[model samples]
Target: MVSEKENAHFSELEKLVESIKQRQQVVIFPPGIASFIAVNILLIASFITFFAPVMTIIGDDWEMSQKAGGQFLVILLAVICIVPPAILITRGKKNLQRWFILLSSALAFMAALMVVVGLTMNNEAIAYQSPPLYVCIITSSLAAFLAQTSHYKTLTLFYYLLHKHE
Candidate 1:
């Protein structure tokens, strides 16, 4: 039912698809290393963010403590977002990197939003002036980006090595 040209075109398409399937079958590394490193950096950043001077109002003074309560809650929220995915990644569950990538991106977004909202509420012009705010935003964003591209990074490395002779 097809012309000779059509038959040759379909054969070329089939070869390309088969090549992709072979590339995918070449799995040399364990999947979680990139995610693990990203999570480690995130954990450290979250710790620093929690203890940063964003809570300047926290003190023996009742009013100051009360005012800082909101800041404390924001830090808690950031930590909560940080910890669960770290736990999930560290637990070594199958296919958890996919979930970790989603969580990492969400954490980055949430942390950035928290920084923006806090800066706006405090009338601060620059997030960089606030250690916790900017650090959380920057580190979470970096970690999310790394987590998302980990697969391609790993695959690209191995693919290069495998085909370098060709």
Candidate 2:
């Protein structure tokens, strides 16, 4: 027969496993505003990447080299914006949340840096204002915030599960 201490330990282990299973199903912002905004931003970024070449061709002002460079930049931005959310949707791995946070923070930082550079550079080509600049800043900021929250939640849950019985 199992002693009282052994039975209690087994019960605690079972509870811990159950808690982990439940937490795995708990997503931070499913079908929520944060996720909606992130998805829309990602879609917009993709659309821009897809149509940028067409826009460059239709508009004669941009030279071939500039058009190519712009297209490359758009593609890079699209990928950076896409990866985190895609991972969250596909894998939902908790340890990878730090990467999402970093990517989103980088996007937000790039947006802010663009604004600062435009304001300080005093160059007409770079100083022009666009609505998408604000959109990028806002969306990236939201994504970063959401990712951070998810990371913290995961950590808290992990720690609770590990130490609650002690």
Candidate 3:
């Protein structure tokens, strides 16, 4: 006992839903592209940081490795951070835009945590004899900044799509 008008209305509703899905595919591009760019920047920074001095012990000719301090840990962490972006760039699902946003936020939080911890660490003695804290601070700060920017932009656009009420 279905009316022709009711059936047509259902058909139209399906089309609207399908159209929104298609548009979402286009909307997800910016965040994914940003992830790709982040991977490249992190890789380059990690390389330069490896050889950079972490600390220089004073008055001691005693041999010490420059790569044995917080910088080493920071560089390793930076490398791990790059892997997520690479995976996202190559295999991100269109339906997982919200998941992408969460991942980005988590990445940003991790980096920001590193920066905060670095700022609060007892670096008075360490700073005199070790590599610059600025390297760890700068590298972590950069990653956090990029991820947060991506999160903000993607979230703004994700919620911008609207359905007509008229």
TM-score: the better of candidates 1 and 3: 1
Write down the RMSD of candidate 2 (Cα, Å). Answer: 9.6
After the best TM-score superposition of candidate 1, give how far the Cα of residue 55 lies from its true spot, in angstroms. Answer: 5.1
lDDT for model 3 comes to 0.45
lDDT of the candidates, in the order given:
0.55, 0.55, 0.45
* Full-model lDDT, candidate 2: 0.55
| Candidate 1 Cα RMSD (Å) | 10.7
lDDT of 1 by residue, 1-166 (tens): 9799857755664455456557754333555455556565774575456344344434334575675676677667666756665554444333455554565566556656766766778744335445665676677666666666745344333433344344
Q: Per TM-score, what order, best first?
A: 2, 1, 3
lDDT of 3 by residue, 43-152 (tens): 44633443243223231343445335545665666566455544443442223334434444454454344445545785454444233434544553465455446453
Q: Write the per-residue lDDT of candidate 2 for residues 47-92, one digit (tens) a residue.
A: 3623452344344497888878777777776666665645453343
lDDT, residue 140, model 3: 39
Tell me the deviation in Å of residue 131 in model 1.
3.1
What lDDT score goes with residue 159 in model 1?
Answer: 39
TM-score of each: 0.44, 0.51, 0.36
Weakest lDDT window of 10 consecutive positions for candidate 1: 152-161
